[model samples]
Target: MSGVLEKIGQTQDKWFVFLDKLESRMHEICTAAVPEIREVFEQDRDPYKRAHGHLLMGLRGQINQMRSKANEVREEKIFQFIDGITSELPGHGFFTGSHDRLYTFRIACINRHNLFEEKIAFYMSLLNNAAGEQDLEAAYQEQLQAFEAIRDQFSCKQCAGQMTIPDLFFIATYVTCPFCQTQNTFIPSTGAQMVLHQARSLAEQRTAHLLKTYEESKPKNSLLYRQYLRSMFDEWNKIVPDMAEENEKFYQRLLQDHLNSINHY
Candidate 1:
């Protein structure tokens, strides 16, 4: 009986030591990840943050690998030991007090593991919030006002006839001169072009509340996500109605992706 107790004590000590090492490793990874995530997000060359997403995905993969390792260790080393001890408890006459102690230890380990998982989740949420905090609506409005200020300043290149740009064009477009019947390429300034690039972001900003509700729901209701997507695309089309067909295709593709992610069959 004393020998069994000694072995159990040793196993418990090893479990705690393993958890301590894991905690230290988790801390190191999380501490290193925060600055890298922020730097990637802030310094991304792509206005749409595509480069940031790609780099951050790699970092998320590393974090997932660390989590997988911890889960594997808990299952293989901790749970297996507890299960083995539990199976032997019924056969041992001297395991009454020891059994209670082992059960208490198991509960403590489970709670500790859960706490670690919560910390990881909280860190991930902080990073996500930071990424989504950009005020894209303000940028869109700034670009729109800049375009409006310069809309009437264009003149035909072929005939030097004063021409009014009737609509907002993101790229160079052929404008017909009424005086000479000549074609002139109207080129937008850099700021005007940025409006097209940020159109979707502005729409997202407009419909972010719906997305927030979807995100806050437990089990992540896909129906709520679909509603948010529809609303967001509606806002997108309102911004750039010419791209509605293309946006609809993109929306369908995203729905298919969501289906693939959640449905096994």
Candidate 2:
């Protein structure tokens, strides 16, 4: 009994020491990666988020490596010790004290692991939210104004007739010339192409107050969240009506995910 207790204490101490070192490593990784993430968010010109996507994938791989190390340590240091002790003293009379101490040690380890997971999640949230630092609404408006200014400057290729773009088109579209009765392919400017990429963010900004209202609710009002989501999608569809079908699917998925979170909570 005394031998088992001493071994358990030694294992717990080693486990805690490893966890402390791992936590410090996690902090260092997140601290070093945050500025890089923010820089990518601010400077990366690709609307497809290719650079940020690669960064996140690498970060996630590193975090997962740390998680794997933690689990391996737990299995080797804690589980092995417990299993060895249980087998060595199968019919011993030290079950009460040994079992109590083992249970406490296991709980402590679990709590530490959970805390590490939560910390990782927090760091990820901070990294992902860095993209919101840019003024998406202003970008959207600037692109919209630019598009409006040059919309009437296009000429038909077939007969050289004047053409007026009747709508905000992010991609190349066939524009029928009024005078020549010919189809002209209209391509938007490089700046105008960004509106489609940032439309959702702009809509979210426009409806941020409603989201705040929902978040501020005592129990987190689902109805308020639905109202906010509906308004946000409405604004998004308003900005890019051509994408309404795809946006509706995305909106439904978001709403379902929110509901799942609430239920799980």
Candidate 3:
């Protein structure tokens, strides 16, 4: 599992770096095309050519919007991935064997990942429509698929072969092998217990490394950092379900007190 987290952390870091480069390239393409688009308008006095500039302008606008959304989605997804991998350690004995800071982090991470996945799907739809070249479109689609696959792979903690409680009950818990019933107490330790512990340790180490890298690599713009923090809080705010019923009771009590005060007066 730790190996999985480390892999996910590395992949997520790469994804963000790739997005940054891709966005820069996309911006350059748009900038380069702008003058050619303008020249098309200037050279051809035809009404069709004049209208072509408007079409180009619209395409440029759409592409820019998609690019912006893609970056936002990428950042959110990266944060979520980091959150998920680090969070698991505390719950599964990462910390003091009790769910604590690590468990909270894990839940936060899962929520963020889920939210980013939804947002990315929307961005991808926009990309599909805005992309001009067939090659570019194909490349973008491949990246999107890769991102989804990676996300899916990171969501689970254990391998398919890992024994579940039910499986354990049937195999090791209940009936001993007839030939080896006397040897039942000679149960050898499954490597899974050791591997799981090792995986958590590896995940924690990788997460700390990634966090340090991200902090060091981040732009020094305070305003941008503030904006990023705000966005993270907004994303976090969306995670919990509403306690409408609880709020309604409070409102009812307040209303009742106000009415009683009026009646006594």
Among these predicted structures, which one has the highest TM-score?
2
Q: Rank the candidates by lDDT, best first.
A: 2, 1, 3
Which is the better candidate, 2 or 3, if ranked by TM-score?
2
Global lDDT of each model? 0.78, 0.83, 0.44
Candidate 3 residue lDDT tens string, 1-265? 5565456656655665655555556656655665565555556554234454465666557666655765576557655655665665545534542234335444554555455445445444443344232222233334334434432221112222222121211012332333323322222134322222233233333344444544675553344433443343333222211323443465457556645655675
lDDT of 2 by residue, 117-186 (tens): 7877886676666555677777788887888899888888998887889988888888899997888788
Q: By the lDDT metric, which is better: model 1 or model 3?
A: 1
* lDDT score, candidate 3, position 50: 49
Q: Going through the candidates in order, what is the number of backbone clashes in each?
A: 0, 0, 3
- lDDT for 92 (candidate 2): 61
TM agreement with the true structure for every prediction: 0.67, 0.82, 0.28
Output the lDDT of residue 36, model 2.
87
Question: Model 1, 98-182: lDDT tens per residue?
Answer: 6877877788788877877886676566545546566777767787788788877878888888888877787888888888979
CA shift at 136, candidate 3, in angstroms?
A: 38
For model 1, what is the C-alpha lDDT against the true structure?
0.78
Better of 1 and 2 by TM-score: 2
